[model samples]
Target: MTETPSTMQMVSFAAWRDGALHSGRQADRRYVTLAELLVRLGSFGLGLSWKARLFDRQPHPAFAQMVKASAGSGIPTLELLATDAPYRQAVDGDFEGYAGSELALTLREFDSSCWEVRTADAWVLSEIQRHYPDARPMTSDEWDTTT
Candidate 1:
């Protein structure tokens, strides 16, 4: 088995729907962070009968509030994240999961059109890149400016 890194660094990328890079809103694209993706994988098993197959943790307090409000108001989670101030604040706060001694992996939505997956695990990053041939790495400057 491959050894996991002691400290993981975030990798940012964009997956274009067209399988090619485009400029200036010309094509449908999803901005993804490696950590968010991992959390999503964990979340998929939340209501299942089997034990969660991926890392799982209680959501941040603010995030839990947004979830409660979204359920009561019948607003979609994505819509809540996009339009609700409290949801945005919760997202801005620490909301990622960490494994062992690795750094926290944050899950955030930059455009609010989608929730990007983020990961600090190199193995996960490599697997995602292999599976997603259309995904391209985002430079630190690009990631910083957008986030």
Candidate 2:
């Protein structure tokens, strides 16, 4: 299996779907291999179940914010690492699950030609096909957003 791309090596995998280029850091990056990615993705289901337990999910802004707050508190959220891991456990420990898991995979495969396309055959083809059926695929030049 290949080594997980370092955080600095990541670039957004730009593709068209739903009507726009769905570009952003793919939610999962630290996992080193396809199996690892899938293994972590498996937990994605379990993680989704936790939201029901949170009713006062207010002071925390968005879902990401609630995730950060939970991770910061004592529980675990998205299993994000710390560049250092002194502050994570259980949930892999990310500050927050970013975009979608498929997006994360796409971002890591940004160098692949298949991923740089308007076609539905992306690194995250299923997600692209599902969420961005009408998005206009893009190039790095076209996807230069500050966010």
Among the numbered candidates, top TM-score falls to 1
Q: Clashes per prediction?
A: 10, 15
Encode model 2's per-residue lDDT on 13-131: one tens digit a residue. Answer: 33211233347744432313212232334444224211111223242233344344444223232332221222211211122222222213222222212122222223434453344
**Which window of 10 residues has the lowest lDDT sum in candidate 2?**
87-96
Each prediction's TM-score against the native? 0.37, 0.26
lDDT of 2 at 145: 34
Ten consecutive residues with minimal summed lDDT in candidate 1?
Answer: 47-56
RMSD of 1: 10.7
Candidate 1: tens digits of C-alpha lDDT, residues 16-73? 2343556765655544432334334444312211101111145455455544553322
